[model samples]
Target: MPHVFEVGELTRAIKAVVESEFPFVWVRGQVVNLSRPGSGHLYFSLRDAEASLAVVWFRGAQGGRISAGGERYDPLTGEVYDRPLAESITDGMEIMVAGRLTVYAQRGVYQLVAEVVQEVGAGRLWLEFEALKKDLAAKGYFDAARKRPLPSHPVRVAVITAPAGAAVRDFIRLGRERGHGAAVRVYPTLVQGEAAPAGIVRAMLRAVADDWAEVLVLIRGGGSLEDLWAFNTLDVARAIFAAPVPVVTGVGHEVDMTIADMVADVRAATPSHAAQLLWPERGMLAQRVDDAELALRRIIGTLLASRERELAVLARGLAWLSPARRLDRLAESFDGVDKRLVRAGTGYLDGLSRRLADLEARVSRRFDARSLDAREDALTRRVERLTAAARMFVADRQQRLELAGAHLAGLDPAGPLTRGYSLTTVARTGKFLRRETDVRPGDKLEIMVYEGRVRAVVTDGGPDAGDKS
Candidate 1:
């Protein structure tokens, strides 16, 4: 009899043969019967019109073999990708996949263990895009150092887009609603189709030649990759690069990016977003203006208050240095001196009278009646001389005192009031009104005559001042 193998042994032998025969291969077909279970593995069938093959892409092998290899790095693009291939897969989509061939021992069936998967049609476009991107990047077109800063307050902006597109309309509306009074000029262009690249380049060049805009905006609505391919053209990219003014691009939705977006000075998610980046919010700007006005008022108020305090200090100092104040001080000194002079004169007279009485008493005790008479006559002569001398001294002091009083009276500020001249002063501040400009109409005034002060309100402040009531 012929030798027979066990079921397990047969399955194992087939698995070894299939894995060795086709270790790695690439397949192209329409995707069908796709399923992703909780095991984080993708199960799908790739079928052409005639044949179908089962495929399994374990999660570990989608981006990279995490434990077996490092992160998924693409040598062609010089970038790392962490996305799962399943994310791009859909039923009935034409896809190309590459993986190793293996046989499942449990089911004893052959399948493809896919490592990479991409849509066929889009993959070609992606390859072109990547090649261009690599070339541009090598030439420093995508360098951050080549990028420019946006203007803080752009006064003139040129918009390049389809005039009838909703993207341009939204941009214009947002600009009007939120911009800081910028003059927006639309440079209408075709943003799609085979001629779109040339149109965009022309629009950019025209806008630059006009030199009317501080910045240029290139914007378009979201669309399929083919629809937005114009922005990825070399002509458009070069045109944007050679623009004299800074260029801002808003080509599509946030998920979409193009070469124009990369080379632009700034990139925005949508046309409306570009407007927002260019101009500040109207309400927010108004609030800032109001805040600035309030701050200015506060600064002015603080300055005025500081000046008023200084004026008050100067006024007090002026009052202290006034002639009238000096005159008052002089009068007080004069009064003090006069009182001291009177006291000294009265004391001297009392001492002389006491000496004379002592001399008369001595004569009464020592001389007889004849000698006493002679002595008395001599004492009377001396007394008369003393009295005459005292009279002269008193008369001299009285004359000197009168002279000083006359000088004091002349220096006195109030002396003029005693005459016909009257003094006018501000009733509110008690400041002397020396000039016509000192008072304004409706100011209260006080008039000082010989008797007393008269209160009045200024009716006219002119060369000839007039007051009433």
Candidate 2:
């Protein structure tokens, strides 16, 4: 009888045989039934007509997207292989997968554990793109510090794009509709295909050499990676870097970004956006002007009102300093001084009289007839001395009073004015004009004398020639 084995054992035995025989293999086919679960393990079916093989690409595996002449790494064994694989393996792409043929022990099924995946034909282009991007980045071509600011309101804009394309038309149309009066000069050029790089370089050079516009705009409509590949060329990127004027790039759609966009001073989302950026809308500009004018008017009105209030205050002050007012104040001060002097004199005299009476009373009370005679003589002598002292004090006080009165009279504002000496004050402000700077040309000055005031205008003046006296 033939020996019989358990089902699991039999499956394991067959798996070992297949894996040992074809430990590593290369399969080329269209990807299908791709499933990437939460494990980050990529699962798909590699199928070519009659045959189909299950393949798995684990995340963080040794292998990455394969490029032409790039090294291939084994995901399962962590070993480098001769055959390279593409970094990304997606459904519907025709790719060459290099991995180890392995057994799924639990399910007891055979599958290819993909380590490397390479795009069938476009691997070289992708390699070149990545290599150039790395080189340019190393040279600081994509540095943010190198980027320049766009002009706030570019009066003249030079657009480099295909003349008949929608990009140029869109740019021009937007400019005409909204760009106040910005001039849009067009330099027609090919934006794609093999001749595109050379055409773009020439056009950029021409725009810079001729100083065509204040700012240069490079724009094109949306297309696939290959369709927009021309913008990614090294020549076009260098030209953009070397542009004399600020460059604004609006290539392809919003999702697509090329090397030109990276190197440009500004990147817009679309051709229409580029136009809007290069020019300000006429209505908006007009509104801005109107706002500025209104603000200026408001500021001027406030300033004028403030000056008017100041002038009014000065006029009021000048009125209060008039001759009549000054005379009235002086008269009131004189009356106060006279009353104080009279009160002081009367108090002193009363105190002296009281002292004399007290001294006489004390002598009468304490002295006998002979003593009284002697005391009376002494008292009379004392009286004479006191009288003399009182007379001298009165004289002194009288002299001081006369002096004070003379000083007060001299302080009279009318005193100087009455002597033909005029008091000059600033025009309209009543500020005492002491120096030449106090009054400028065309200034109206008030000249006040004893009789009245006169208004005079200053035609010309110089620094005072020192005090003569």
Candidate 3:
């Protein structure tokens, strides 16, 4: 009997067998058809002259776990190597890849899942560079917010570079021409080889500590990647990040970007560009100063004109308020008032003279010397008669007043009291007591006599109780 298998069943059986037979392997070839989709998964074909194999590297698989040279490692921790294999890989690069063979069940195709990768020639150095870059980026050293703006016209620029190199010379010459003769302080440092990173870091620290310049420029001429590897070191990147003042980096050619450039406050394409960015040309600055002076003169002239207008207004007001003018007006008013007063006085004196003459004429006609003598004699007779009548009236009134006084004296009640008679009154209310029934036996009494008043308590008061009243 012949048996037929289903398509899905057949594919699954083949996938199981191929994956089990080649679970892990190492393949060496030139990379081609490298494509990274938006999902961050790398797909490529490792091809030789005769054949090719499909391979894939997921984004998460980059620093997950890898094995190289018969040893296992965690690329994230830098346990065994400086960097993971993924970072050093590129298209057309001859590489040795370590991975597991896996089969896609849907397509029924077998592919290599890459775990580790390494470049053929410059594998180690590129790996270290990648590692340091990743580390510093994770620590926020390459944050855009931390970058500082460059000075527009720096008066003093401190340069950290090799003194003997063409980079320093170019920088100094350009700064002199464009920077308006800015002072350049060169902190000579080794820009290549083993001792370069430490030397650059120390120079940067010293430049900052000494307050050397307003802006610091770290420059080096264009070189191969190996020649410029010192600027790509972790120490140099950190030094640039930690500088107190703004740091400008110009390392290698325009195409090359080192870690120092990424961490610096500002990145320049070349040493000459760094100088141009730091300062303005002398001729341009002189033009700007001249423009500013013209603007200042215009402003001053406007202000002076406004002040002069204000002073003229004040002078007009002061002229109106002058004391001499006020005194002149007052003198004019006084002259008018003095004329009116003189006219009034003259009119009044003439009226008085006319009235005096009329009164004198009336007196002269009405009264003669004989008539005045007759009036005097009549007045003397009347005065003698009035004197006699007043004497008679005064004597009569005096006699009548004496008689009335004698009558009032005889009728006085106090006069009776002085002649051995006494008057009694109830002491509580001051009522006169005329009879025995006027008071009670225990009542207090006041007796009025000639010399003094006597206060006594009544022992007996009713007629039936005592015979004497």
Candidate 4:
């Protein structure tokens, strides 16, 4: 027979399958039948032309959607945002949502637990960015093997950014605090607007021609996809790729990925991070130095202690090698041998005395007549005890035999007749008559006494047969 599942069991199984299969998804549809309950949760259905799906957005679960790049960003501009878009969902609004699929066990229905919702519009810039990224990737511009390693500690670092921008200022400040005394020289360029692509390329060419810096750092702050399009252009990507020295990019926010970032040797989340990547932190370096000094001191102490132990051992050897020490050691050895000889002689004499005493005891035991007489008396007493035990055992057995024979005589059936009690039975059937109802009047019956049984006919057989007699 097929197994039957309880209602709760079936619901839980469905919940697990639905949740695991569609843990996260993006769905676009028109919202309908929206509800705002007092529990601070939004319940609704999203439907396309063909089908509808239920969606729930709990207040506590409401949050921004993270992109495939491992961070959240605006759906249109591609700039990172923190506020949730679920609050803007209304009745009959067409939107795109990202969430997970799960079953509501109480209602026995599956719904999307929406986290992020976006009103669909103006995504051309994002599309163009994706197309260029794909093209550059196909050209092997984003290969890991093609990327160059940055110097361990660059003495001079070049920044290709607007001289007055916060990105440059943040970079320089972080460099001063964390760097190993590396000089930062800014190469001025436009970071946004139509002229930004060409201006960035020019700054790169200038830095490459100068060739004074060990590494090139390109940086900018966060912006919409349109504002950051210059970094996504092929011109800037090619310039970073063709640079003589290694190029590091920190454009836009951590979530933003531009063509230049994909092509550069290293990518940092922000301007501060780029500087951090370029040089080791000053405090960290100091800590490392302190740790090394401590370890070195420990090593030196261990070496000195080992040498002192060796010196002590050598001093003991020298003391033992002296003539006086050797004479004292020989004198102690001679005293030990003399004491052992004395102990051996005393032990031998004690063993001989013990043997002589043992022989004298054996001779006295062999000649003792009283012990033999006492043993004979003990044997006679033991024989008397055995004979007494046998007599008592036979007497007990005879008494038990007599009692058993008396019990058998009492169980005999003839004993009751001998006591004047008679037994009667039907003569023809040989059945004992327990009551008068066993026979009718004139039926033949037998009366049994101690000696013999006598046959007779029943004259009256009724309920009052005994009273009539």
Give the worst 10-residue stretch by lDDT in candidate 2: 71-80
> Could you tell me every candidate's TM-score relative to the true structure?
0.62, 0.53, 0.49, 0.47
Off by over 4 Å in 1: 1-54, 57-117, 318-384, 398-469
283-346, model 2: which lDDT tens digit per residue?
9889999999999999999999999999999999987889777877877887888789778877
lDDT of 1 by residue, 240-265 (tens): 88988889999866666889999999
List per-prediction Cα lDDT, in the order shown: 0.84, 0.79, 0.78, 0.81
Q: Which pairs clash inside model 2?
A: 64-87, 65-86, 65-87, 66-85, 66-86, 66-87, 85-116, 85-117, 86-117, 86-118
Q: Can you rank all candidates by TM-score, best first?
A: 1, 2, 3, 4
What's the CA RMSD for each of the models?
A: 12.8, 12.1, 28.8, 41.0
Residue 26: error of model 3 in Å? Answer: 14
TM-score of 3: 0.49
Superposed model 4: Cα runs more than 4 Å off: 1-25, 29-33, 44-54, 58-61, 65-79, 89-94, 99-115, 121-135, 178-181, 192-198, 223-235, 253-259, 282-469
Residue-by-residue lDDT tens digits, candidate 3, 28-123:
789999887888888998999999999998887776444433333444222344455566567888986768888777776778998766554444
Query: Each candidate: how many clashes?
Result: 0, 10, 0, 0
